[model samples]
Target: MTDIRLFQGPELLDHAVALHSVYVDAFCAPPWNEDAEQAIEFLGSLRVAVRRPGFTAALAFGGREVVGFATAWTTLAPFPTDRCYPRAAAGLGPERTVDWLCGAREIDELAVRPQAHGTGLAADLLEAVAEDAPDGRSWLLTSLRSPRAMSFYRGQGWTQATHPSPDGEGIVVFLGPRHPAGALAAQPL
Candidate 1:
């Protein structure tokens, strides 16, 4: 059986190495194909991310080994310009970006070790971090390159808010099930 725990603020750093291992296991293979440098960079970013307002994280452990994890925080106003934030904002436009995303809970990352893929651990971790989201306003951005990931979130009831390019090779934004603007998303062709 897997045990899941929630951590808030910088306290999450206590298990940094273990969490990094789970991250590498979940993302460095197959469709993701991320490298060691990217994993190291994630560690560095986690340090800063944990300090963001409303930051929360959930980790799944099996016999003292981390098998999955998820992180989230409240999105602030003006919207960010870095990372994939710009892509999300561009897709939603300035008005919806601020009105729908700002002040909402933003799920930053969710990863489950390959061995734990079919065990429902990913969904548990996602809910653990987002359980307290304000008004159930939550959102996330995922790569369209991974059809499995896209399917997983959709199966979890998240609504796809952004339409990917014809080649389906870009970031796609998803609004959590209860997001007020979920009905505003454009249906895919």
Candidate 2:
């Protein structure tokens, strides 16, 4: 039997090792094809990210062994000066980006081990992180190249904020339900 647990920032910090292990196992395959270095870097990033306000995480375990996990945090205004944010804003448009995404919950990561793929753990983890979003706003970015992943998000009611880019190398942003950006859900591809 599997168990799902909701964790606040502090608890996430406490279970960092388990979280990192599950993350590496889940994302190092297929579409992600991440290296050990990338996994280590993700752990480093999580260390800082959990400190952010409104950070939340959900961990799935099968008798003490983590099988899946999800993490998210509220986006702040002055909007993250990150490289990806700027590019995302370009695809999503500055108005919708700022009005709906700023101060919203951004799902930074969600992964489930290959052995558990057929199960519904991913959806449960997603709901755990998003259900309590402070502003009832949530969003995430996934590669359009991965049809399975995109299908899963759509199945969960997430609307694509950007269409498949002509270059075919860009990430697709998804806006959760009730977000103002959802109105632009059908913007031209």
TM values, all candidates: 0.97, 0.93
lDDT of 1 by residue, 1-189 (tens): 899998889989999999899889988997999999999999999999999999999989898988889999999987999999998998889999998899999999999889899889999988888778899899999998899999999999999999969576799999998898999899998
Question: Which runs of model 1 end up more than 4 angstroms from their true locations?
Answer: none
Best by TM-score: 1
Residues 22-107, candidate 2, lDDT per residue (tens digit)? 88887788777899999999888988888898888989899988899999998998788685787788876778778878899999
lDDT of 2 at 140: 90
- Model 2 lDDT at residue 133: 71
Q: Which candidate is the best by lDDT?
A: 1
RMSD of 2: 1.6
